[model samples]
Target chain A: MHELGIVFEIQKRLLAFAAGNGLSPASIASVVVEVGEASTVIPKYLLECWPAAMDGTDMEDATLEVEVIVAQVQCKKCGTVYPYLEHDKICPSCGAWECRMVTGQEFNIKEILVYEEDVPEDGSLGGDPAVR
Target chain B: MVKVYEIKQRVLANNDSEADALRSELKQERKFLLNLMSSPGSGKTSVLMKTIALLKDDLKIGVMEADIDSAVDAQTIATTGAKVVQLHTGGMCHLDAGMTRQGLEALDTDGLDLAILENVGNLVCPAEFDTGAVKNAMILSVPEGDDKPLKYPLMFTICSVLLINKIDVLPYFDFDLDLCIGRVKELNPDITVIPVSAKTGEGIDEWAAWLKNEVTAWRDTSSSETIIAKNKEYDK
Candidate 1:
């Protein structure tokens, strides 16, 4: 439900980043994003919201790459860390309910892949210098 | 040739910063904004009516009701004679800091001591985005079951106060109050849990007292840093 808003936010940031770097929106190859398993942001929903967010932005052809981070929780009682979903919010090692989430609630933009045209070594702005 | 830009930034960072800025702005205006969230049919409107009845005489209160599409909540809250505004999220499930700011502006909260933003009824999306409120609260009615904390950990974790509403119906339902509070505490150690029945007015005094104290304390404090620091302490 919230994925549409998130996609718009990502698109806004991408626009600003592209502007700052002097890159065209079409030059962007793929946008990489990392989401934690516990972040409540479903990667599937983000993917579904991507096309609508990119529509009319001139970057609809660009791809969205989503990377999910597994959720881990650290037991406060026995100082043991384990995967959260595997143990059901309990310390797997100590069998205790007291535990702190160490990781998983993360939503970040990792990087952007852009295709830059190769320029000739003679300082001339040429189209595909290697092809010539 | 492909060039990579290693921009490792949080997707919600922009919203977070905007929330912080709105917090500071509200602090400067001496308005204590409270973002109330819950699932649908959680008696949020009923609780708001009761709360307004209790504290409206003591403080200048304004309410901004956010819904995907509805003016019903605004109409209900208008009966209390307090300032009220209805905000349509335009099909969005949650209200971000920007939308909250726009709502506040529409309400014209100049000298109000408390501005309550009744967020859209959804446990997931609202908790993920901060509405720039001084505090976050959610209501979990007995009929909603006690295992909600396990299902919606982020919602349980982000809330500063958890109001276990519909206590009057506890005799009919199989909800375990102790186990529910325990589960919530496991997720958030510092959360204040209050069991209230908005219908019979049970525990409304304590909830109203808490809000009154928060509003008064916020006005007494001169520095915005103190408020931010205090909020940050429980928000973690």
Candidate 2:
């Protein structure tokens, strides 16, 4: 349910981008998002929220792509980087409990690809270029 | 003609950047904030109420209560006479750093000695977001059972302090204290575990004392004019 807020934000951003770029609301092809394992954001849940969020927006046809990143932490004492699994808090190599996370725990929309309607020789925008 | 385009953007990174700014700001104030996490019935509110009752007169305290719905907890804390703010997440299961920053802005921290943020009740989502808190503390109520540490290892592992609440019910329930603590330690050896029963007020003093010492240490470190000056300079 909370994912809806995030999905709304994503939709808002995509729409604003499309409007700013002089692209029609329906021109958006897809939205790419990056999520970190530590972020606690379920990819499937976020994807399921995309359509409802885009319902009345120009990006209704846009596809959502989610990339999950694993969180990696570096041991302060041993200088070893290890995956920070929920079950294992200690460094496998040195048994160090103190460590810094290097990766994962990311939630961001990386890109939105929008296809603009081609302008005709008369300097007017044409509809569905394929029809010509 | 055909068109192909690729653009790279990080969506959630924006929130992280803002959170980083808030973290720096809190650190500059020389305040060590603790973000307490737990499930709805995990005894977070009880522990906080008891803690405030014990330390309110001695330490300048501030609290931020986050909940998906209701200002009930905030109203409850106001009776304790501590500086407090109630944040309604509306419907979000987690409270992010931006929300914490907004709450901090409304709080008067100049005279505050310690700030405790009671994060929205949840084990999964709250642990994922950083609220610019120095420590992440979690509570596991006895009724919730001893297997929580294993099932929700992420919450246990990320927490700096783990409180086993509702110990008074231990006799009534089959909760294995040693097993729970052992599992938590296995996942996070550095985590400090405290068994408490807020209902009976037993073991509340120890938790309160631990919190007092933590806040005192932070205050002592930040009390120096030299450090304060350095922090001011860093902020500029």
Candidate no. 1 TM-score: 0.92
User: How much does each candidate deviate from the true structure in C-alpha RMSD?
Assistant: 4.0, 7.5
Q: Write the per-residue lDDT of candidate 2 for residues B130-212, one digit (tens) a residue.
A: 66666678999999999887567678877777889999889999999998898788767778899999899988898888888
Scoring only chain A, what TM-score does candidate 2 earn? 0.80
Model 1: residue B54 alpha-carbon error in angstroms: 0.8
Residue pairs whose backbone atoms clash in candidate 1? none
Model 1 gets an lDDT of 0.87
Model 2 segments more than 4 A misplaced: A9-28, A34-39, A55-61, A67-132, B1-11, B220-236
Candidate 1 structure quality by residue, lDDT tens digits, A1-132: 788889999998887777766667777778899999888789999999999889877688888999999999888889999998888877877798677778888899998877766222443421221221
Per-residue lDDT of B80-152 in model 1, one digit per residue for the tens? 9999999999999999999999999999998799999999999898888888999899999999999999788
User: TM-score of chain A, model 1?
Assistant: 0.86
| TM-score, per-candidate, Cα-based | 0.92, 0.73
